[model samples]
Target: MAAYVGRGVHGQTVRLLGTRVLAGELREGDTIDLGALSTELDLSLTAIREAIKVLAAKGLVDSRQKKGTFVRPRAQWNLLDPDVVSWQVAAGAADTFFRDLAELRAAIEPAAARLAAQRRTDEDVVVLRAAIDRIAASVRGTAEEETAADLAWHRAMLAATHNEMFTRTDVFFAAGLSERDRLVHGAVHDDPVPSHSAVTEAVAAGDPGAAEAAMRALLDKAETDLRRATAMNRRAHDDHERGSTA
Candidate 1:
């Protein structure tokens, strides 16, 4: 899931089990049979146990005296973990994930923009400008390039806030945002450079109010583009289904 390149048997086992849990193939409270999994995946029991330890750290699984190792309730999950986010995105939960991301951005980013406008250094301005240039250059490039540029831009914006918590939040969300960008960037009708530039310029100008407003406007456009992209994808899927039946 999520183009993960597992490093070893332990890593591979973690990915396999993590993806299954996120995909709902292994539902909440369902016991994970380590011996069975070891047999099935042809991995060592130690590998399977190590994988479970990793998942437990991520809050995806837990053990109890009577229950054995079982999937935790979704509420217990570390949703902000990059691996968790990627697995959910790969599990066809992209729509819900995108919606949640939008809401989170709406709450955090405009305020971050305001702080950035107030606190950003000259170096921050340079980084933001460079990110914008990359975004502009990648507009017509491959989806991977475009997504990377967009993520870089956002990461720069968060870094400009000079707040550790804000920067950490961006790191947590980066994986999910990358997935969203890959899906929506190709479908968006409007050029993204200008909106991003508007926010950057406001921050560079040290205008907190303007920076906040600009960021809000940018998010509005992004939400609209996401809706359009989701609708188009649904229509395409419906058309294919109809054609299959015909």
Candidate 2:
């Protein structure tokens, strides 16, 4: 029987294969045969090949002349790839995935905010202000609105840096940051108006130091919330394990 059987077969295959590799069910150096997968998944060789191609594109697998396809090392995996990160989270490692994301944010966002403050144009401020308005509306609006606005806000800040490389990394931030925001908005119960506004205000004022400090403070709150959420997830997982054993 196939590991996955359903509609959107190739896309499902990509997620299933990627998730297994991410969850270590298929470890580094593990080789897979396309023919074997076709037989197991009840899929055509063409389907299996396409799925493997997608995975290879994402750096999850590599094919050699004689070795077939093998799982790449975790270090070789594109951690910044949104699909990879989404698979990692879907494989039930959301706590660790998001924690690592928080650390990455801590490293990059403050500096980005600082640069945005230093380099922002009038148009940038307008966009920032519009995003902030959307976020404020999220307090009373749909979850989708909040997530969209939050993403826009973060993307705007990154773009404000005016650094080509930094702007391009918005993809790295997308899935993880959205997940983090959902967890935070649900769990922390803190009003983000003041915190988000502080950063915007600092940027608008062209205060790099204040913007950096505000961003650090914002992320510090996020990290704290994530730690709390992770602890809760650990407890829940432990409880589930104990129950299963019982």
Candidate 3:
């Protein structure tokens, strides 16, 4: 997941506070002492205020004359924001993030595949094929490479739909998907190449029903892989805890 922060001190301040809030170091409804933060971080009041404004825009914090600046409830956060999603994953919430991402993909990708099959141009087919090739190649490469290829493949799928709204949704969920891909790619899972190839072939053949079904199958496998990965992570953590206590 990409870190989107302002340049220099402003960006640093926002990242510091945002991570604290997302990581639960600063709980919801907890008031922020901007003056103390400014002193602590050695940033000017203007820089701290600017960071607060940025966070407020993302629904992370709010201020009033009497109440002062405070972290908002999680329910009020713009969870769909990529930066927020990135921070959450960074805060070790990858399991929850992956589960949410799978649910969202279940809602979006199958429909997108169907639309892509119906609406895709020859150029779209080329892009989709190239993306699949990248995915295949990256499977033997580094995890980050595989994650990037996976992201490109999904983006290509969405773009092929030729629907503005569907394409725009990519920005909101890309971070979560990036984290998901990294985890799944690094875990013990089935070969993603064949599943991805199936969807691309269906899209290229302009078979809407086949495309949707293939994408659904792909998502089913993805969810399974995610669950497996999460379970493995939990077991590893439990083992570490036991060893530490021993």
Candidate 4:
């Protein structure tokens, strides 16, 4: 399973098949043929099964005793799964995925910030400050570095809450948050350091209301940036399609 896990034939099959389902090449209720996939991909049946298991865990497919494996409805999909989030982005669902992620953040982060302000330990503050410093350092660096730092900063914020449920969802937030950071960074020219710093200061001050307000403002700005970025992407896609036909 480890050998078949990443960038290998098994993993590639998982991504290809996941992308197809996400892109609507395979719609809900559509069944897949194991034998056909094996022959077409020139992969062993065991490898194919391993790939399917990965997809299944993401709520993309279900297998019955004799019914084979079928794509699940969109409502059944676990969008919070990092792998699913990554597949959605890969399948050109960035606008929808990011919008949903922004909504989730709006609902969760403010509360988390408030809780962190109330419950944060000295260690939490230290880690949060370090993560913020990392973000500041990456402002003039590569997008990848900035994205990594941004994710770490948010993860640290969640950890500061001292709530297992909030911290446990960190993995689910990983890909979506990283993708959101990438899009917002590419679209907006504003320096986000001050906004982030505000949250840090509020939390460090043990001011719940102020921390919550700062976090809300940060999320609000992100949503605004995401809307502008999505609109630009839509226009570009339309123009490209028109050019292709012309």
- Relative to the true structure, how large is the alpha-carbon lDDT of every model? 0.88, 0.83, 0.87, 0.84
Q: What local lDDT score does residue 198 receive in model 1, on the 0 to 100 scale?
A: 99
Off by over 4 Å in 3: 5-16, 23-25, 34-57, 63-66, 90-96
Ranking by lDDT: 1, 3, 4, 2
- Evaluation by TM-score, superior candidate among 1 and 3: 3
Worst 10 residues of 2 by lDDT: 1-10
| Model 4 residue 15 lDDT score | 90
User: Which is superior by lDDT, 3 or 4?
Assistant: 3
- For every candidate, C-alpha RMSD to the true structure in Å: 3.5, 4.4, 3.3, 3.4
- For all candidates, the clash counts are 0, 1, 0, 0
Comparing 3 and 4 by TM-score, which wins?
3
How far off is residue 23 in model 1, in Å? 4.0
The deviation in Å at residue 233 for candidate 4 is 2.5
lDDT of 3 by residue, 1-246 (tens): 345758887776788788889999999999999999989998888989999998899999999999999999999998877778767877777767777778888899999999999999999999989998898889888888998899999999999999999998787678788777776776765788899999999999999999999999998888888889878878998999999999
Best by lDDT: 1
lDDT of 1 by residue, 110-155 (tens): 9999999999999999999999999999999998899989988998
